[model samples]
Target: MADKQNVVSVSDRIPALKEQRKKRANRRLIFYLSIFFILIGIVVYFQSPLSHVQQIQVEGNYTGETREIIDQSALVSGESIWSQSLGSAKERVEQIPYIEEATIERSPDNITHYCPRTDRTAYLHNNDQFIPVYGNGKLMEEQSLDTYPSDAPIIFNWQNEELLEAFFVELDKLGSGMINHISEIHPSDDDPTLLRLFMNDGIEVETTIENFASYMAPYPTVARQISEPSDGILHMKMSPYFEAFNPEEYAGRFMKSTLIRVMVG
Candidate 1:
């Protein structure tokens, strides 16, 4: 009787043991599936195309050769986005004189990136034609009227090349419209301290190197004061004012009238 009862108990426990083995197998499968998904995510993150830059686009460039400028600017090309830093790229590009500013961006897929470059256009009237001067003073010799960008204001002579360059930079600061209306700039190498300016609207401006912007700060209001663009010397040396000179009295119409005007006035 004892042997028969022991056999019955062993048979009853067989189904329970099988059920526990199935539960253990299911847990092992779930663990393997979780590890597989994590590996797939890491591969996708590291392998995407946004990893480096594939193309570079340059704009607002005149007189500068694109490939040469890019090389000089030290901008990297045909590399993964993940390898390049935007701040480092910007600093490198700014080293080029023609590029006033640069902006870099990466594509969403990490495969490609682009750089948009801006060039500051400064017009220098030389030999009867208006020539564009880059920030570094390089002359744009390309003679394409149709292909040329919009007209920039002609840089009239100030004191010297240095002073005139400085004046062109400070031009935007002054609200004076004369920069747009000016036709010619004649610098006196004799007294470079005095910048004699000629306007297209038939006027003369005599300003010095020190306070060009300050003198011209009130020029818009002062323009209303003049009936016509006075042909005489508008002296800014002593005070920001104008003096009409007789072309008949002076051999050359423009003169260093600072001493003459102060003595006469």
Candidate 2:
């Protein structure tokens, strides 16, 4: 009975030792696997070309100051992309006054992208004062009429915000050369949707806001066809056509009509 009991106790001890050995072997396998994966990650990080930035690309910059924006980004080539903070770089690029918004992106092809949108500027004329208009016709700093440049059209008595936004949208569609010929823009008193455009060549245009771009796009071609020193109203509301008028006679009629209306009233 004593010999049988001894054998049972020894058998139980043998199984416990095997279990302990198996547990140790599993632990060793897990530790080795962890080390192996960590080494592989390190090797890939150092050896892969994607880990470094090789090129910097800029887009959506309207001022043509791409180099300035890239310099401001502070993203140096050959730098480790893993260590780059894209958020911080984007913030720096947006510091430029003309840039309205900026976005940054990185790719595994070793490229860093910096995109910036510039604010659109226009001039608003109130009497003798010229105010700078930013995005969506929001007025900025005011300047004297004498100092205002002819680069942008001067808006006259345009107080409606919605109409101003639509006007800018249409104006932006026209090319810079076409826009340069426009000297002043006024909201028509007769119709809120109609706008009166005064051209640099002393020609006037009457067009609606909805199709302003389509009408204005062909203005340069139309102006060239007319006789030199031409001064008249080009009605572009429905059908596009030009009407010749004697400036002196028109002015006299205007004054006389104004006086007669005032006296009658």
lDDT of 1 by residue, 44-157 (tens): 866865444566655555544567555654546556556667677667766655556766655643322133433334466555566665544445555323332344545444
Encode model 2's per-residue lDDT on 134-238: one tens digit a residue: 443455452345576677788888878888888877776765667788888888665778787888988777787897888787787776666655556676644
TM-score of 1: 0.58
Error of 2 at 12 (Å): 30
TM-score list, all predictions: 0.58, 0.56
lDDT of 2 at 134: 49
Q: Quick one: RMSD of model 2?
A: 8.6
lDDT of all predictions: 0.57, 0.70
Task: Tell me how far the alpha carbon of residue 19 in candidate 2 is from the true structure, in angstroms, after superposition.
Answer: 22
After TM-score superposition, what is the CA distance of residue 221 in candidate 1 from its true location, in Å? 1.9
CA displacement after TM-score superposition, residue 210 of candidate 1 (Å): 1.3
Model 1 stretches astray by more than 4 angstroms: 1-35, 41-80, 83-92, 96-98, 110-121, 125-150, 155-165, 175-178, 236-238, 256-265
